[model samples]
Target: MSARRFLPGLVVLCLGAVLARGIELVLGANHLLVAIGLGFVLANAVGVPDRLEPGIATHKLWLGAGIVLMGASLTLDTLLEAGVVVVAVIALVTGSTIVVVELLSRNVFGLADRLGSLLAAGSGICGVSAIVAVGGAIRARESQVAYAAATVLLFDAVTIVVFPIVGDVLELSGTVFGIWAGVSMFSTGPVVAVGFAHSDVAGQWATVTKLARNALIGVVVLGYAGYYARSADGSRPTVRTLWDEFPKFVLGFLALVLVATAGVLSPDQLAAIENAYNWLFVLAFVGLGTEIRLTELRKAGPLPVLVVLIALLVASTLSLATLSVLL
Candidate 1:
């Protein structure tokens, strides 16, 4: 590609990242949610001029890169600190949520089994990225993926904003509060920021807990991949199916986390890793925002929105209740 042609995309990437991070810092909250909501508003109420769509749409690649940086923040020590019981608790909460949502999607909502299962897993697993990966693997329709992503983004915003408030109201200890937030929130980025915004100790606990939760993504994906591949054939799976079905970025993401946690990397090196990760997050959110049709979301009617709200309520209730009894 010519330099002139590439420059516009490169510029968009930089600007979107800077804008997202700046907004996050200025808002001192879940600014990504705000940006997404604003994007929805602009696209629906006002308008995204046709000329600017391409630049905004290029954020998907950046989001991928951000995910990689997020892995760098993970360390073996952090995982170990979360403990067996905490791990078990997270497993149960996330696992059960997935199962319940899956059943609801199919039985109650009367959606197709595969798409319903994917949404349940995504919502109950690691949020948008998880949903996106599973959707690709199963060759899910655009509508399914959009609904799943919307579910995650909506709850993510709610959990990130509301969890801290509940923690304070309950007068929960820093450790218990952090663990609650960590286990409940689907995505690591917003949870970490929110936990830290509340307390340093809470931040530390939440980061460790969130990463531990994320580590399960690899396990879940691998399990699904293995099952699907084997069921397809006793031999090897086809390249087309495998490539389309599997999310290759996940392995790279885990590797980045492991390498950073291995104690070989210096502080300066870690800083570089974080920079790359943040940009990827920005890009991913941008892609999500770009693809979202606000009018369509509205037209999908209140049922989907109601489902999201119910899930959020269940998650929050479970989180704080768990903290009360267990902590």
Candidate 2:
């Protein structure tokens, strides 16, 4: 309302963009700017205090902007190019990964059900956004959400760097590599970056597969909402659960897909929209890092890492298998 009140968020916006643009220059013309953001999130999670949570403070605006910018990159053409079987494969692998991660997190690692579910969604869905949206809807603690984000960032970094090399060594086609990367990688931006580095076809199909993967976030969140409601009320849920916890911006994301499909914006515009979101991704990560305590990650014990590794193995195996079959 007041200028003083608005100052903090404005500062976050400026800092996020400046750091993101700087990283863009350093990375030498690449899309891994999101990685910088993700790294920032991990750093903050380990050492930064709770008071400096930028992503939380600016919640509604940046979250929506990030969702919208991501949406701008989606299109029916990209989906068609990726093909129905490939799309189905992406969905199935992601779903399986979530279920497997949930099982391991709860039964094996002894994590609370809510925390495990948040981690599972973060691992299996679109990364921080999905974590935040699902965490908020399910009323999970900020600490659990932060930990899930950190885990996703750590593994996503590994996959983004490692997958391309694997693709090359295996001598896979771009389409196959893209499908593999898109399905296995935790974040869409990195998948796009890795895919493009391999081939144009890889990039296109990776984007398509990632979008298809993203489409699951809203559905999963809504399902969680229903599950939670049922747990709370001792009855089946309907319209009310949807109203309370459904991620509304995901709808806006779908609308952007329609607009892109219709060719309303030029390529440059689409690129700019994606770049803007990439910057937000960076800021969200930096904000995330600013809040972390390095010692806390250590204290989370080896089990979290083990759980993540198992999920990674499952996802990677499924992704490569899908590639071998589909492409």
Candidate 3:
């Protein structure tokens, strides 16, 4: 709990974030992805010393803070502007993706129950954050958490490039492409990048849609918590248990949304919050990249990958078709 324990890793993350920004400036690449790549290279090629591991582990804290701050960039008005139809589509796609991944992972891939749940939450909600939240809720093994996170991270990297290319090929409008990426992509960073890659309008839509999905993380995690608790004890989870497992950062996010919707923050203040969240995400993702050991990912084998692939393909194609018709 001491600051010293986290200082070393925080320093590394900060430096990595700064370097990612520089790379973004010079090469015109997405800073978040660059941050992840830099962390991966350092962890895999250069190697992280044992002394830094404790601090690096705090990346989740930074990620949670980033997400909460990001809420300032959105408002109820923004969501309302996206239309009730868009909200309905986001809910439907998110729910369906979770169900499909769970079914495929269990019935077809034959993965462990906890691992399947981890993948389901990751694919259905906010990627690594959701995986971590649900993993803890279900008391998943560390290996299962690692495997699920790696699978989601891999897809996030892949989709960042592929979605934009697909949008261009299909000649989809910005709104359609943004909603598609937002609904289908594994993580927020990649979805945002892919959306902006199409157009600013697309980026806004993508962020809003993705946030809608993200808002469901607490409910999903709570459900998993109760299910796993009941499975373990043959008794329902207590109110205290569910409350303890709830993601408090989600409350922070929702509060910020209310504040923003109330017009409490000036445009300058909103911009500042946006900048803070962006930098926090860069630092957090750099830490995320460092955690992804190629050997660890390889241990996940092919089953989980196949499960996600099938789910993504089905969910994305259906979402695209629906958006094309609706939007």
Candidate 4:
């Protein structure tokens, strides 16, 4: 709780963020990915000092804060403007992806329940953020979280390029391509990048659709929490217990959305908040990257990747087909 206790890790995270920004500027790579890559190299190749461990462990705090602040960017007006058809498609695709991933992970692949849930959340929702949120809600192991995250990142890398190519090959419209990518992609960054690679209008549509999916994170997380709680005890979770298991940051996220909807934040203020959350996410991902060990990740084998691939193919194909008809 003391500032001194966290100072060492915070210093490392800040330095990592600066280095990530430098890498981004020089190489034009995604800063979030760069941050994680830096942390992974430092931790695996160089090694984190024992003294810095405690502070670095506070990455979860940073993650929670980032999620809460990210709420300011998700005004209700944007969702409404995306239109009812887009909203319905987003919900349907998101929900179906989660269910398919969960079933494949648990029934077919024989993954542990929590690990499967983590993968489900990652595939079905906003990628790493959803994985982390659901991991916390379900009390999943760090190894599992890392494994799920790595899989999502892998897909993010692949799909960013592939989606653009597919869009061109299919001669899809910008609106259809954007909505398809928004519904099917693993992460927001890749979704936006893929969308814009097609056209400006596609980029805007992708961002809105992805935002709608992102808004469902809290709901999916809570649902998992309740299910896990009940399965652990063989009884329905009481309100008190469910409340205790709830991620409180979600409440803050919702509150910020309301405030932003009411026009309480000026554009400049909202931009500032966005910048803050982006930095927080970078710092948190650095810490997450450090926690990932090659040995531990290897224990997960290739099943997670296979599960994700199947889900992605199904989700992307189905969403694209559906969008062609709807849009």
In order of appearance, the predictions have TM-scores of 0.66, 0.66, 0.80, 0.67
RMSD of each: 5.3, 5.2, 3.5, 5.4
TM-score, candidate number 3: 0.80
Error of 2 at 289 (Å): 5.5
Per-residue CA lDDT of candidate 2, range 1-327, in tens? Answer: 444655654466456557556666777644343444444564554433344344345634554566566666767676666578786787788888889988998788798887788878877878777888778777777888877777776666567668878988999898888788878887765676687668767765776677667777768787776677656632333456535435466577778889988889998998888777655655544443333344444544467667878987888897788668765
Query: In candidate 3, which residue ranges exceed 4 Å CA deviation?
Result: 105-118, 128-150, 164-178, 187-207, 217-235
lDDT per model vs. reference:
0.63, 0.68, 0.81, 0.78
Report residue 205 deviation for candidate 1 (angstroms): 6.3
- What is the number of residue pairs that collide in model 4? 0
TM-score of 4: 0.67
Model 1, span 199-268: residue lDDT tens: 7567657756665676666556555555455444323324564455344555666787699778788989
Ranking of predictions according to TM-score = 3, 4, 2, 1
lDDT of 3 at 267: 86
Instruction: List where candidate 2 sits over 4 angstroms from the true fold.
Output: 3-31, 34-74, 102-119, 126-178, 187-211, 217-247, 264-296
Better of 1 and 3 by TM-score: 3
lDDT comparing candidate 1 with the true structure: 0.63
The local distance difference test score of model 4 is 0.78
Candidate 4: segments with Cα more than 4 A from true spot:
83-87, 102-122, 125-233, 320-327
